[model samples]
Target: MEQVFFNEAAQDLKTIHDLLRWSVTCFSAANLWYGHGTDNAWDEAVQLVFPALYLPIDSQRDMCSGRLTYSERKRVIKLIQRRINERIPVSYLTNKSWFCGQEFYVDKRVVIPRSPIGELISQEFAGLISDKPQKILDMCTGSGCIAISCSLVFPESKIDAVDISEDALAITKKNICRHGVKKNVTPILSDLFSNMPHKHYDLIIANPPYVNVKDLKSLPHEYLHEPRLGLITGDNSLTLVLRILGSLKDYLAFHGIFICEVGNSMSDLITQFPDIPFTWIEFDQGGDGVFMMTKEQIIDMINLYPIFNV
Candidate 1:
């Protein structure tokens, strides 16, 4: 792809600047919510196609406004208009989203990588690696973003990414190849732990479908674009969570840790168990619905598992 370029400014051309000013005016009128954002998502969109971008408003310092010829100015306005019309997230249109300050590929097939897990992995589990896991399992690894981040952070550890869908696994493969971690991150098409080999994983991590049926249906448009199988849980999100909590102890090695992201289901998990002690993890970036437990903890807390008809 050619780097977007800007022609030399026309000293005598007032028409170009006038058109651009009106274009931004129209963009602000149509996309005020996005225009006013700190990241300036709309302004960024304008800059992508219109490299000679400069606006007079709120940009009192560096690189905010400039002159774009008619064609360049027209392109940026149309792009922002397309975003407003389609309701597709600007992130998808850009084919990128920030995770742990690193840009990653994302599309409608996979959920955008927003889990705080990325931030956690950046600090190498926040120096939480008293016992370095030899083998790691990423359950329901949709786009394999988590697996790729883990492999990058822990260069010596091997990773296994499991999911039931071939489409998701295919994307996972793409990311593995993109990040060049194919040798370290293995992909498995499995329903939970059903198809996984009974190997002892030092750390088993999951960001499974914990959104209850009703809750899943009401997610925002950006989230609706993602695959529901990895986000929705049936018969209450408890079904899948309990299944993992019950069977995880069997698959984890002694001193092994199990990390699961249950999101809103954390409240439900607590109400149901009443006494199940789960370690809620905090991320440097924003995220919720994640909890941690050990193999010994799982064994001791085994009685709290709810036997649901999954």
Candidate 2:
């Protein structure tokens, strides 16, 4: 269908609300997927429009009447075109995404931060954690949102953010500085725990690429904009996850807790190691497939699963 207001010779859209409504209509008509950060057309429109106008996302209703300058209108239209035509995620277009209620710089170099692990961090691990962690590790710390958010919650904890992709680490470094948690969060270029220093973490968290090959192929166009290395695992979707589990015992403190977000791979993971018990975490806000385990539990299961090489 031809977009009415987004076409040439169109001049009716003028106010912020007008453009937002038009964008929502355009997005819905285009059948755009909204899994990256939003779940519907209206929220996606606000994500695109509010940042484009340099206004707060929760701005007052009166601000919607403010008129957009010609340049601003052109810029908004261009962004909308990119969203509908190119299928780029809004965060990549705006170079930002919010996680755990804090904003972080983002781009195609890294996956957008939308992990449910943020929920765990916001609650500071609550009942799962017995004591304050002095050291933490965020494996596959894309954009460093997990590590940065941890720093905010545990100000005294030292965080090591590790990623194999140098480009992703570069983005993580930028976010670490952006959040002003430089001293506490350290970015490391490591594939899992290979290059990480010999140190034990009281808590280790990962939001690794757990999408199986099949699922990766069927992801929406918006997800295609992200780095595939940050999403696609091997056929079983446990390639990286198993590797992490293999080395977890060596890096986790005796009482340390491990949290990993495996997305839809939870069922496959359970099937692979049915003898081992994993605490499937549920978020009140919404999100699933994340599991938590204690170091002692992993040690006990290591012998039962050959993946741990016990």
Candidate 3:
């Protein structure tokens, strides 16, 4: 197909489509909104752009091929332009994202699912945590991805999904049903262990909003589309992580472990708690600051190592 160009006199949909197809290949659909442009050297290549990565044209919906006619290309280009003008994430443009080999519906209601928790589940933290867990607690379980993944890997284990926002919980519930894991995964609306802890958890996993003030202040345009409440926390974002870790002991069963992903603040946490042992979990995925500690670990740290308490 020949490349097309935009015309101001009268909109030429065909010409616009050709230009967009040419333009899209030179740069990523996500990168198209950014500051730079790319040279048209690479071959026209396209892959599964996520279920949520919607094509910009209605004419191309049923067709899976990347080839877009002139008019079709123009429609998609217009959509991208609109989103760029509005500063919306292209993920939201498609309404889907892939996490742990599963396609999940995502919107501005919650943050996109990106965490080491998925990798940890694949490793079966159930087996790695020293004590085998029969019950799991997924705190701040947005979209229920963590809880749903946990329930699948640990069939015999029961999971409690806790979140503060009701709308987020609704999305999570839908995912749980989508995967048919409702029997083992329970959704509860609690502001961090408020409704639970009368019961004990064998393992507690959390991927809270630990992005510090600096990151939050200047997050990428794509991230701006997510609910800010789920990203920015405190001046350092350590306050919520600390409060959550401090509260874990009360709900954890004896020898139970707690895993929390604090993003880039793991070093900061280590400096803050020099005495308490933080078994930071290593990961291949691009996630850091996932620290693990058992109830016993916290008990000793609180009683004997008060200097380490943040």
Candidate 4:
């Protein structure tokens, strides 16, 4: 293979600033889609370059002009090539992802943690849930990101991180240990609520698989790297989500809050049960299709839409 020169002026990219600039140009030219923790080429480049160089992501102020060793240049270049040629997400390449301001180990075994529920967790689910939850449930917990984040926010609360995929649960357990929440956050192998212990949770949050058949087919290459089980909900995209709704009331305690992310399937969900008054959360950092409903509302929904009465 021929050497790809990101900069025509220099035979080799030397400084951190040089590599950062070059990566942005290559990423922009590749027309790569960003969404796995970053939204633009510049941010994506910074994520790739800084981590590859063993520097802080926020260290651009002091290290932008710092020179890179020959070996360091090679590592950064190789990661850049993979980012462009293979279209792998930077998080997967680095085996790291950040959620709610904390880092977690990640790879192809689990989907990268990018849920907006982090914002709500940081806010202690304020104005939505009247009190700090004593028991929290994270359904479809891919990397245990939500469950672990909840553990940090609610140190006194116990959390159950449930996922159907054993492979995903392995990653979840690793993250659990990584964050040292073994006492509070417990990983469970369950298909929704099918295997869940008969316990009521004060807060239940899920970033479930909501990609329908149509969107799944057209997803970018970056998404292809994530586990299919974590992304595709069903043919109509509501299969898993509907199942969650059906059993959630059984496990959700009185005055509890239920939050789930359907992404672009929000319209389909609304159409399926038009009468249910779902409270859609508005994230200031930019994400949509996450709906919240109290336990009372969920019971009301079950009454109105008997199809969910399973």
TM-score of each: 0.78, 0.96, 0.79, 0.96
Candidate 4 Cα outliers beyond 4 Å, as residue runs:
1-11
Candidate 2's C-alpha runs over 4 A off are 1-5, 8-10, 60-62
Worst 10 residues of 1 by lDDT: 1-10
lDDT of each: 0.69, 0.89, 0.68, 0.88
Candidate 3 versus the native: TM-score?
0.79
Candidate 1 has what TM-score?
Answer: 0.78
Clashes of 4: 0
Q: Which stretches of candidate 1 lie over 4 Å from their true place?
A: 1-76, 304-310
Give every collision pair in model 1: 54-64, 54-65, 54-66, 55-64, 55-65, 263-289
Q: How does residue 298 of candidate 4 score in lDDT?
A: 89
Residue pairs in clash, model 3: 4-18, 4-19, 17-74, 52-94, 52-96, 54-94
Put down candidate 3 lDDT per residue, 1-310, tens digits, no spaces.
1123222211443343344454465345434333111122121112112122344333343544444455555555544454445655544655655567676767778777878678888778744576557999999888888888888888889999999889899889989889999999999998886777478898999888887778766766756677767777868778778767667767899878888898887888888878878888778765667888878888777676553365
lDDT of 1 at 23: 40
Which candidate, 2 or 4, has the higher TM-score?
2
